[model samples]
Target: MDLSALFSLMGKVALITGASKGIGLSIAEIFAAAGAKVVISSRKQDALDEMAGQLRARGYEVTGIACNVGNMADLEDLVKKTVDLYGTIDILVNNAASNPVFGPVHDTSLEAYDKIMEVNVKAPFHLMKLCFPYLRESSNASVINISSIGGISPEPGLGIYSVSKAALISMTKVFAKEWGDHKIRVNAICPGLIKTKFSEALWSNDKIMAHMMKALAIKRVGTSEEIGAAALYLASPASSYTTGTVLTADGGFTI
Candidate 1:
């Protein structure tokens, strides 16, 4: 088999959320590097616009849009803009998520709990539904849901946040089965502790970092680029036969 064919993402158009920085931004950059036109969306227009400029300057096709995933109308606008600019969205990366509250589940307020579920689970669901038409229109459409390793193995202080990720795992399966008929592959990537702003509280603490490192097979935290490469494989024709699967890029943290 030609391995190069498996890694190429050329000619594809990808729409990624929470793409201003961290894993989302890394995924968008990698996709653009692979010759895919990428549209990045986030809550902050300034950040998105800045990143878009950097990518565009590098000769990659990229654009930025402001979108708050929890808002359905904003999500619809995001999709509409993508279609207007790119014609169709061949790849959809549901990377936008939030964990506003941490600590015990019982101590967490209803408002915080609801917000976590809304951003992590509901937003992705809505995006998929809204993008279904464009996705089905593609000859080789792919949907990537960003989940957490905590979903499979709950953490001590991450109660509601972990629960939401668990829902995402289940959601991935449901969508993959439902969308398979359209030949739109759906998959999830469960990233371990990465050195990103989203996970700074965990990885930045010396004590917590030490404990996490002990459990990791690689003896280190994973990087955003690592997850980006995995996403590229799934989005590309490399894994055409793959669907309804979760690729754990946790550096053996689960093991």
Candidate 2:
């Protein structure tokens, strides 16, 4: 079988959140390279504009929209703008998330919990709803929730953040079931210890990296591009038969 044929995303229209940098940005680049019209969103307009310009310079079709996923109005606007520009949202990658606090669960506060839930959980749900019309219209549609490996198992120090991701995973399953009739596939990617700004604390320290390596089968931190490739598979025709699945890219941390 020519496996590459299944992975092609050419002419697809993809909308990605938290796309100014890291995994989100990498996904944007990969999808664009594969000939998709990519729409990137983040809270920072300047950064999103810069990234969009850079991608356009490389001959990719791209657009940038400043969106704070926590705000329903912003999400509505994001969906409207994408549809206005491209007429449809073939793929939605819910990659925006938050980890405002660390330490034990008991030490976490109501404010922190709410904050994390608003971005990590609620926002994705809202975005899905707002984009449902466009997604339903497409012959091929996919929704990818960027969850974390912490949600799959547990991380004592990550408390509420972990809880939020767990809820996201649950949301993926529910949405997958509800949207199946529309031929829209909903799934999640639980990334392990990736070398990104969001996980600098874990991989930046040599001692922590050494300890983490012991538990990982790959014995190293994962990269954003690695996660990007995984996102590509889930978002493209490659994973046409896949849905309601949580694809883990954590370097075998769960093993």
lDDT of candidate 1 at residue 237, scale 0 to 100: 87
In the range 173-223, model 2's lDDT, one tens digit per residue, is: 999999999999999999999989988877787887788888999987899
> Largest TM-score belongs to which candidate?
1
lDDT of residue 150 for candidate 2: 90
Candidate 2: list runs displaced more than 4 Å: 1-4
Predicted candidate 1 versus true structure: per-residue lDDT over 1-255, tens digit per residue: 987767777888899999999999999999999889999999999999999999999999999999999999999999999999989999999999888776778999999988999999999999999999999999889999999998898876788889999999999999999999999999999999988999987987898888888888998888999999999999998889999999999999988
Show model 1 residue runs off by greater than 4 Å.
none
- What's the C-alpha lDDT at position 164 in model 1? 92
* CA shift of 161, model 2, Å: 0.7
